[model samples]
Target: MPSRSGPSDAPRWCVLGRVPGGGVARGRVAAVEVDAAGERSAPIPIATAELPAFVAARERSAPRWVWSDTPSWYPRLLEAGVRIERCHDLRLCHAILSRSEAVPDRGPLLAAARWEAGPGAGEGEPAESALFEIETPEDAPGAVPHDLDAALEEFDRQRAALAACVDPGRLGLLVAAESAGALVAAEMAAAGVPWDAAEHDRLLSAALGPRPARGAKPVRLLELAEEVRAALGDPRASLDSPPKLLRALRSAGIDVESTSRWELAEHEHPAIRPLLRYKKLSRLLTAKGWAWIDEWVRDGRYHPVYVPGGVVTGRWASSGGGALQLPRQLRPALRADPGWVLVSADVAQLEPRVLAAMAADGAMAAAGSGRDLYSGLVEQGIVGTRQEAKIAVLGAMYGSTTGDSGRLVPRLRRSFPAAMRLVDTAAAAGEQGGVVSTWLGRSSPRPGDEWEELQARASLPGATSRDESRARRAAREFGRFTRNFVVQGTAAEWALAWLAELRLRLARLPSPTSAESIAPARASGPAFERQPHLVFFLHDEVMVHAPEGQAAAVAAAVRESAEAAGRLLFGSAPVDFPLELRIGERALKE
Candidate 1:
């Protein structure tokens, strides 16, 4: 089931393959362990020449489904053992497999080869699996030359050495599995360990060179010793992330040689363990999320992802496509169309700002100046220390514990009664599993009647076992609602303001001609005329793919939109709701 987009859930994905003019292929499945299955399975023609791609869209979300480029592929598919049920048509497919509860009438097709897999490959499956496809280069637009085909085949084999990891939950392997395996082989060979073809443990031990060994360990033989040969790249693997990750032990000296192994072994340094665990869980959730998104990409349709009215408040979303949950490790994979540039942007400390507005917490708002807002709080003497401030503020916003926020919340109650009382009420409601609604009609989901009865018993002295258990569960569910109701509701509002600003400001941005609506640019590239089109938005950020020439003005529009949104929400509250700006050939570095 879907969980909050946090460490609690595993990474999810709905990989989509799209082409302009609205043709597509979308898969909400992770083809980790079952890569060979998908690869070996016959391709079915979900869409035929006679019909639009939607024909197979119906069955896209069954136990497993596949859609080929054309219906003619269906004949080839039947030869491949995959069954085709009539319910697998487009409309029914979507109806059965909903992208969201409201958007139930949409089902995403599965990649044929990757069936029988999930958050992680289960028992009886190898730890690694992958899909290898040869796509005609958009720029080159041609098939691989005979000479390249051999190299490509070899590359795919080499990639399987580690890249085909079945367990995305294992952060260590997920980050650089294949790369690590190749490196380990090199390291072992360099150690001058005895040549292989002997016992697996003996060879690995010799390759690793003098490590303490456990007694009586089982070993699996490596496949494709030849695949282990291709690690001669100039730049070595990365042990560092540019924007400092939030942990120590990794802050400075890290060894890729060891990291690679740790990844393969699904282990990490003690200090790095939490990060790895979070990565695993995050991947699970992300994978699920993508499964929901994949419905759009199959058959290569240009269904710009829709951003209902833009912001949670009011704004139009992408009609069909936009990489929203792009992790720091995966930006490079998000490419743009042949002629289009990918405009990526982010809203810094968005939730905090919303919190500031919702609580009318002047001091918190002051702390959220234009910069790393968390760090900004460091400068304030509101708390005895920075760490204290961080924990306190975070606790207040997310209802977390084990921080200064936990300690200071009591003090905050004494100092800022209004803010403290408000969240406290929400918190109380949440603890009881009640969904506090926003100012708008969007109420959080409440517990059922059974839950209410359990809760009542839970409050009673000497409650029975089942009653106590039910009470605990109800409290947990309610807590989630109370904690998020304000932040999420206000966030939705801010999104609307930003969208509204963009919609209005784009008018003044500078449209050169009505024929094609040329957006301005900073330099020689495109620029907006007056208003730029509001192309996309992630949870708390927005992106406008406009002309390059009018970059600065468009940036200003974004800023103005944000400030206006702040004003619209807080009504000139004493707060610094600033929108930091970044622009470049690609998405600005976060």
Candidate 2:
């Protein structure tokens, strides 16, 4: 490994990619340098085995690591006890810049067909057979290339694209924040969320009775099943099957078309209540029951593999353990250690805040200033009440033009015309098959070929009224998706910024003393044992497990990070991102 430190003023980047044939898990590292005179040097290749030491020595210089995908590379480095402070994830950034409206020159990126491939199988999965697998004939257009040469080429193209962006600074910030988010995702999975198996078991037992024997139902579930069967007047009816349940309901004159809970609740059937209860309990038993606990929870920690940039809108998706869809009933199992407290903080009205900022809607921003945004709307006479304000705002963003939401949206349009115009314009774009983008340049995917074909057929010389109507409905459906995509996607970017800043702040805090260490902290691994660290993150919420003595500090860091994220995204805009912070032994109930 090379050890000489470079001058502080120079910029350096290490690009890592898989080597052709190395049985010992070897790869290639290219050291790229840029001097103060704007002079660039050719990439110097180093053997893969020397990476850890080289990276460790370069840590002090803090050069950014540019790689094909963060997940593929970072986890291995982390296991080697190496941590990278900064990176430019070529795959993630390529997804953003290729379609970003801000990018003035996307031709090179758009033509890089191999750079558009979906992420590798998520963390912990088997590695793909080939690193730079050539795009197949059936592969999607613009699939990202995976080898060293392709990574370097894509990185160069992405940099050029950023340089050609309308707001290069903001777009650059977005890419950096996105890469930081990838690091956070990997670290969170590595540390795992502290979970209490016993508490989960107790909650399950209380809710659905003791775990049943091999093939039998639990006491409460069995009781509910019997009650449902009796009320339906069909002892032989299989409550477990949706088709059977629906048939039973109809035979009993329930007049419901489906066994869905909402439709069933609307009816006055004698069996509806118990059937709903039974379904809820059944869901709990199957999704997060004893089997789930035994498989996911280990050493008092629940590790979930997080896939960053997994969704088209740039939101993360979990591969396993239902990390993103953790049911509220099971939240109590998110227990902190004996000497630790969980700083669970979630922003209120995140999308609306992002919309206000992005649209530069001063009145809307003023309404949400330093208070509950919905209540602020109510106080400003934008709507009669907080509930109405919420409905209208959601309806506008979601492109609802009927029902209560639709009726209420016009009122919001009158009050917050700028904010309404922002989403309405996005909706219009989608309706016309045009692309839309988030505040930070994450572009919504282009309409599919089938969607394009539908519109084309509807516009033909002899198109039927039915064809036109179907096209119109499909366009409107897509419009609603685009309308929400901008706000939701931007909100996700803001969240990534928040997490990145908070992670850095938490790292700066003092590590817990040995005396303060607990089982959960120990199980969290070397990177996060003592210091305040983020353990769990949902869209707008994050729970940090911290030492009890540092709870106040962690709370402050959370708030500070929120503010920092707002500033990073919107500069000095008046829009506020206020978090509903709760520092407690466990996550608080809403």
Candidate 3:
């Protein structure tokens, strides 16, 4: 398989373009490629202002870039276009662009850009312009197949059409780079297929046939939401409450109250209004799709699709359906199979360890190794109370706006100057459109032009008042990045170590009793095993589908692996990355 651990080390994209200097206010830009069919092409890595801060924290020796010519179900955002920054090291850059995925459709058309020769035929300085000097496959060679230019031009259009086919069968090797919708890369030197644009268009139109006319308005969300008066049922009541659809989740061992807390913020976003407007979006793909969901539970073991690098910052996605989005109450859906148990654990305040290192916070580091850091914060007069300590520490580390963290942050700032400075600086960099890096090589990317403009103007001579307002604003902006980069990056390291250790343990186990087990469980159903078969990981969280016999062993391995990673990363995890965990079916504790 393709090492989809990450699409490209820098993040996959589909567009590359430039915003004119000092021009977030001005939107004029030149695009790298636009298919004859109207779709555009772009590079996968971010550029503009987003380049500096968003890079990931991988091993220092890992490659800087990886490309995907084949289609991927994974999410790779090339906002407007991802800028393919010329590798600062030419050899590396050359090797990367050489891939078919990086090949240009028309080899930089001079005619397309309105050409004008540079100052001199051989000026010492080459124009920054990316247009290439097309060398029409010439060399006093044999009378090659028909006009090479025409054949090549025809191929581009056809390639794009084939790409849009969306056939499940196109799931193979680096096939042809279909310009179908401008997302393909071709290797295996086969002659370009002959495809006339007009002909292909006709075929596509014919294949689609007459589309159905406009239909009824989409279903409403509230209509689909049949409210179950209480949370499933009261513990003391008889089986008195009639279980509503999907509400029976409480019976399956999920903690309904706790999971709801994780998604509380999801309801506040301005865009969520639309989802509320069109409620059916919450329902299945369609009513018929309901059967597909019913089967997941009936089978007894939930197999949430594991998507590698699913989040914008390189997290994975769940796909057989949105497994990550499941309500905490339905965790019982992920019950153990006959001879298995679930081994699940979550890292406590992962981003904080990263913050301590990034900020070089010795106090926080000391607490991380010596005790439960969050509790330590409460005991050490870091904040007024336990909850306040949690709020303040998280606010310091993550730059969040929720609860007392929002208020206590300013107070914590006085006590934790260095760490606070780091966050402030990162947020400043973010506002000023600069990159931020972790202990590892990953850096926060620059925001594109729009965000960049906001940062740039915030710095001009007339930008702010005597209060040092703009400067403060910019500092905090970048600080947001600085605050999270260290924690996020280090947490990632911990996860890698955890994953590696779990894999080793799993490999050592004897075959399960049931070979027919597609999804096996440990002893009984429901309780998660603490085993090493850690099959999945999300930022700061790990999920292990362990056989019942080895659940505890797996859990121990998960803890040890994390600590080991901390030791490897920073001499001793006690002072750098501290491992803390709790287990149960639901993802959160009430």
| Candidate 3 or 1, higher TM-score | 3
**Alpha-carbon local distance difference test for all models:** 0.40, 0.82, 0.40
Order by lDDT, highest first: 2, 3, 1
Relative to the unseen true structure, what is the C-alpha lDDT of residue 173 in candidate 2, on a scale of 0 to 100?
86
State the RMSD for candidate 3: 19.9
Model 2 / residue 548 / CA error / Å: 1.3
lDDT (Cα, tens digit) per residue for candidate 2, span 391-471: 988888888889989899988888888999999999999999999988888888888999999999999989999999999
User: Number of the top candidate by TM-score?
Assistant: 2
Across 1-590, the per-residue lDDT of candidate 1 in tens digits comes to: 44445532321211111222234332111111113222322222222221223323422442222221112122222222222221111111111122112221122212111221211112121122223321211211121111222222222332332233332222111112212111211121111111111222233333333223343221111111111111212122222342333122233333333433354244334334433433343343333223323443322112232323222222223322243444443333232222234344567777767777677877666677666666666666456766665677667766655555577766545544566666678778867665564432233455667877888877788898877887886676567556666676557656655654565575555563444333222122212212244444565666654445556677878878778767756677776666655654444455
Task: Sort the candidates on TM-score, descending order.
Answer: 2, 3, 1
Worst 10-residue lDDT window, candidate 2? 132-141
TM-score of 2: 0.92
RMSD of each: 20.8, 4.4, 19.9
